[model samples]
Target: MHLFAMLRLILLGTTLLFSLITLGLAANLVDKLGDQWSFPGFAVAVSVLTILAVVPMIVIDLLRRGALMSWVVVELPIMGILWVLWLSSAALSTSVGLFLGDCSSFSFDSALESLCRQYSALQAFSWLNWLLVKTYVIVTLALAILALMKGHKRVWFSPVSDLSFSPTHTHSGEPKIPPPATAPGGYNPDPRMAHNHSASPSSGYPPNQPPTLYSPPSGQYPPQQQPYQSPYPNQGPAQYGSPVQTYQSPPPHAAQV
Candidate 1:
């Protein structure tokens, strides 16, 4: 898109330069010819040509940012103004082209012929003045029409960047996942899964043995055994009992003796 925009910028600059040159030459020609429409025509031409000069730069800049509407907004008026410029200049230059083309054939006073053929500064010898004006006029008209069309902008020069109205991401993001369907009694919808889900000890564990709520007698996890206690009475702890001190009582016979 930037490439396209840049190309458009280049085209615009080229057109702008052509337009400036044409405006200058045509204005000079009108001035030298001393035609009746020269004053007002040049006035409009100057103002419109200023717009022609300035707006393309603005449009090209706007295009880089993908401001299509903004570009259209400024460019629509530019197109309209260009239409006026084109038509006005076309009429003026076409008349001049005809005059210059036929001036030699027509029989007129020497002074009148001289005036008609007069070119003050590089008007006749440098290049064809009417041709430049006419070319610029046609170019302006073509660009104007192209600007008004929606698809033409992209086709003319592909913009490297652009704005889009459509959403880039889904509106609600990730889709919601539903719970798996169940049977009439809330069993799994699938028979195999339901069977696996309802495994029992008497029924035996499922062969694949997927996770389930039913506990079987130890297919994978064995029940832990508790240590057995000895049932004999002598088996209890006696080492830690208090030491009994038995006093040897003097025998009664000894005491009596």
Candidate 2:
């Protein structure tokens, strides 16, 4: 069990014990007094109500079941009601003259003194029960507020004992899965290429026996080449094999003579 849960159980059990004590004393006082006063009867009623309500809640909490009554939304209101009841019972008991007066000073009879002591005990337990209820309510409310502020909106619907107030803890949303490895320009590399890149040189094809290149199937051949054409269409082709003619300078001198 959680530390918080265990503490809650202990506090609840103590409150339950106090409620039982208050119930017994109030019932006995009511029987002896016979409805002469209304406070004792009120105390008896509140104690019975507390016992009936708290017993089932304690059982559910002990079982750690996710029942409707165990939810914070439901439990808070129930606890608030009980808090008010205990406070009223305590206040009414305090108002009685017997609770305030000294039992030994006033009562000469031993039985009457004992009865006065019971009234004092009853009043004390009623206040103690109210204080216990108040403490639980305040602590629960503070935890709920802290959880809400930390983005745990669903905490209101969840069991108080099961919740953690740590800022690092998350109650909702799925765990994020990281995206696949990507290259520059948003390209995802092929798994095979990545494997090859990471593989040891000795594990792959030998350095001399490189991987084979793709070839055409069976009898297919490349097409024949076409003849080349000159860019200047009007120019004649040069005669490279013919000899060059010599210049006739003597014919010009013969003409002058």
Candidate 3:
């Protein structure tokens, strides 16, 4: 469990880093492009769009992965995306304020300038951000729509718990189906009923065997026929230091009547 938690933490950290980088790039693009580029508000919209688009998919993916901490994994990506969006918004607002000369101009460090300058060189970076955001939105909506249309299917990738848990017939609050019936010619095995039956001839039986039939002695009157014949009459009962033939009989007077 501890190991699972640690793994979840690591995945969370990675997602956070991914979000931070995505937002950082977007912000830098906005800073360089300026408000005159005519799509200044697009980055904020895209950031929002990305969050709405990716979160549920990430949740579903984590669930499908069978993560022990799946909820945590889902939440981490969501929080990361939100953080990125928030950061991007802050950065864009600051840049816009500077552009309008309504706020104090902050000098960029060498690294910050380098990053912004990289984005500025591409007149297409602003469009690229919008494109990415739109693509994410479209794909996510398609997936969600597909899910709704399918109406909770029993997909192999889906969790077994989500599939049909209802019993077709119930017994004792569990699905009821008689245990597979014994094979037709097979012995009924019961350990506690206590009979010594063996699997091989050396072990007093043979594979796929039928029990040996006992033959009556030549002049023993063929034993009196009992009113009730035993199903396993060939299997004699232990008696008098030897096996004896036994069968069920009616009470004596009742039989005579």
Candidate 4:
């Protein structure tokens, strides 16, 4: 019991730690957004929208709520935001539209001097940090998301009091009860199916279908008997070339009699 409690605590701590880190990244991204805004083209538009969507979700993840924290509640949105940042960064390369004067021709000292002109302190600065910094930031953001996903998940309840728990299913090492039969949840019924489906497999009729009378295929009926004929004397031998004859006639049940 203590071992389980320890594992859960570790998971909770990791989840919260990732949340804090992602929060920091979100703020940094928001600040960097301003630097990218002046760039022309559609990537800027996408970058703006992505940053806008990401910041609030990160804030929500950082903010405390009454409900218990879970993967979907706290980490799912942050992971999605990280993916968006990955994609948007590709679309908006750091080299474009920052108005950073070309430092290619400047010597190391000359470049540092230009920084004063741009930032009211030096002559210039090198943008070599642009690629490496963004790459590092993205990698950390991805790791935080990964750690959040790897953390243990707890039920939305107070941990103080508990009875025995019998789980029907487990996902990612976490015990879970199967969803309610008819609820709109992970185990929900298909929307295209009928509502009155039978709960028992031994039902008389197929589930969701009304009872139907079975019909045999054409030509599958039993063989029918023909009427019996009586062999009697030919009254007149109408053709005159045939003999008049009389014979014993069998009864209806006489075939075996």
Q: Which candidate is the best by lDDT?
A: 2
lDDT of candidate 3 vs native?
0.43
Question: How much is 19 displaced in model 3, in angstroms?
Answer: 4.7
Q: Which stretches of candidate 4 lie over 4 Å from their true place?
A: 1-43, 61-63, 66-78, 91-102, 106-257
lDDT of 4 by residue, 1-257 (tens): 44423433343344334333333433443354554443223333433443454444334434643323323334334444444543444335343433355554345566444432332211011122123224433443444334335432343132211112222224463545444466443345543343443454433343466667679897899778898875654465366667645566788897987
Please report, as a residue range, the 10-residue window in candidate 2 with the lowest summed lDDT.
167-176
Per-residue lDDT, model 3, residue 66, is 52
Off-target runs (Cα >4 Å) in candidate 3 are 1-20, 38-41, 52-221, 225-257
Better-scoring candidate (TM-score), 1 or 3 = 1
* Candidate 3 residue lDDT tens string, 1-257: 23323433343344334444545565665676666543345544645455454454446545565543233334334444644554554445445432332122324466555544444322233334434433333433344334334543323233212223221333232334455445455644444322454443333343466668788778977656759875664754466777555567879999888
Model 1 earns a TM-score of 0.37
Mark the 10 consecutive residues where model 1 has the least summed lDDT: 158-167
**1-257: candidate 1 lDDT, tens digit per residue:** 43434444454555455555655555555565557545325533643565455564456556455444334444435545554655554454444443455555555577555544543222332233234334434544455344334234332232222222221222243323445775454443444465654674423333555556866765688778999876544533556666754446688999987
List lDDT for all candidates, in order: 0.46, 0.78, 0.43, 0.39
Model 2: lDDT of residue 252: 75
Per-residue error for 121 in candidate 1, Å, reads 15
Clashing residue pairs in candidate 1 are 1-159, 1-160, 2-160, 4-158
TM-score of each: 0.37, 0.65, 0.27, 0.24
